[model samples]
Target: MNWVVFAIFAYIFLALQKGFGSLISLPEAFGGMAPSLLLIFGVYICLSARAYLALWAMLALGILTDLITTTNPSATIIGPASLGYLLAGFTIIQMRGLVFKESVFTLAILTFSAGVFAGLTTICFFKMRSFSWLTNDPIEGWDSATQMYRYFMMVLYTTVLSFPIGALLYRLSPLFRFHEKKSY
Candidate 1:
């Protein structure tokens, strides 16, 4: 894997996720869905790359995501997003061999599943931290039911958006292909 190329892609993804993601949002009633472009990109990279490459990239991206999105004034904790992405990466790596990576159906399923897992893992991390020794207060407005509903909506939205994005990525696979070419 080319580190320079991967870094450029990661920066572009972060910019998109931060700049364009906020512009597109659903109503509050429907959980105000905001698409996770980085997560989707991570899914694509995981499916297309080797295990080691995918793991490191996902970890770095996840940490960067947490740093960019952190708004809490009380604590400086930043493991939720990282942990979530790591779990998602691992899940995709484990299941990569079983599914057709180029299939839109497979991408959709994997994206949705990974989104849900990331969301739940994030929630769990926050919840755990809230009860830890360092914190005396719980996360504000922490409603499990509402959070789960919002996560579900976000997962659905991400899944729907993944189709077109996945198609484009699939078409461009040759550029980022990890296998070595052999001359006959």
Candidate 2:
């Protein structure tokens, strides 16, 4: 697996997302969020890697993601963010070969599902066990539907952007190998 490419993409996406967040305000519903295409791309690229190793790497990326997301360094937020990203990465592992076929329907379904999960995760982290706990100040002002919509939109944007961006990156660099691993 190309760990180098994985690291590069992760850094760039994280940097850009962080920069954008600082320059402007993310909508209330989608506040404190960033597009994480690199994790997904990492999964796609390392489909053949050992599950244990992959899980650890994704977890680490998630942690790094949390650290970069906020300056306060909240363990509560960091834990869930890592878990959310890890969940998305591992879940997508099952769909490895099918994802590269260039299909919108597949992408929409995947993004929608992942988005909901990710949304619930962070909400749970910041809030109590349920989303109702989020009704306390910044998040308190947001309605449930609005929060859900924001999450959906955020992930949808990432998925839509990732497809072409990943494809382009795959093409631009000869390093990406399409051949499935036939042996361990």
User: Which candidate gets the maximum TM-score versus the true structure?
Assistant: 1
Clashes of 2: 2
**Residue 32 deviation, candidate 1, in Å?**
1.2
Q: What lDDT score is found at residue 96 in candidate 2?
A: 55
Q: What are the RMSD figures for all models against the true structure?
A: 2.7, 5.2
In model 2, where is the ten-residue run with the lowest total lDDT?
69-78
Give candidate 1 misplaced runs (Cα > 4 Å): 71-76, 132-134, 181-184
RMSD of model 2 against the true structure: 5.2
lDDT of 1 by residue, 116-165 (tens): 88889987777665665867567677766787888788888888989988
Number of clashes found in candidate 1? 0
Q: lDDT of candidate 1?
A: 0.82
Model 1 error, position 29 (Å): 1.1
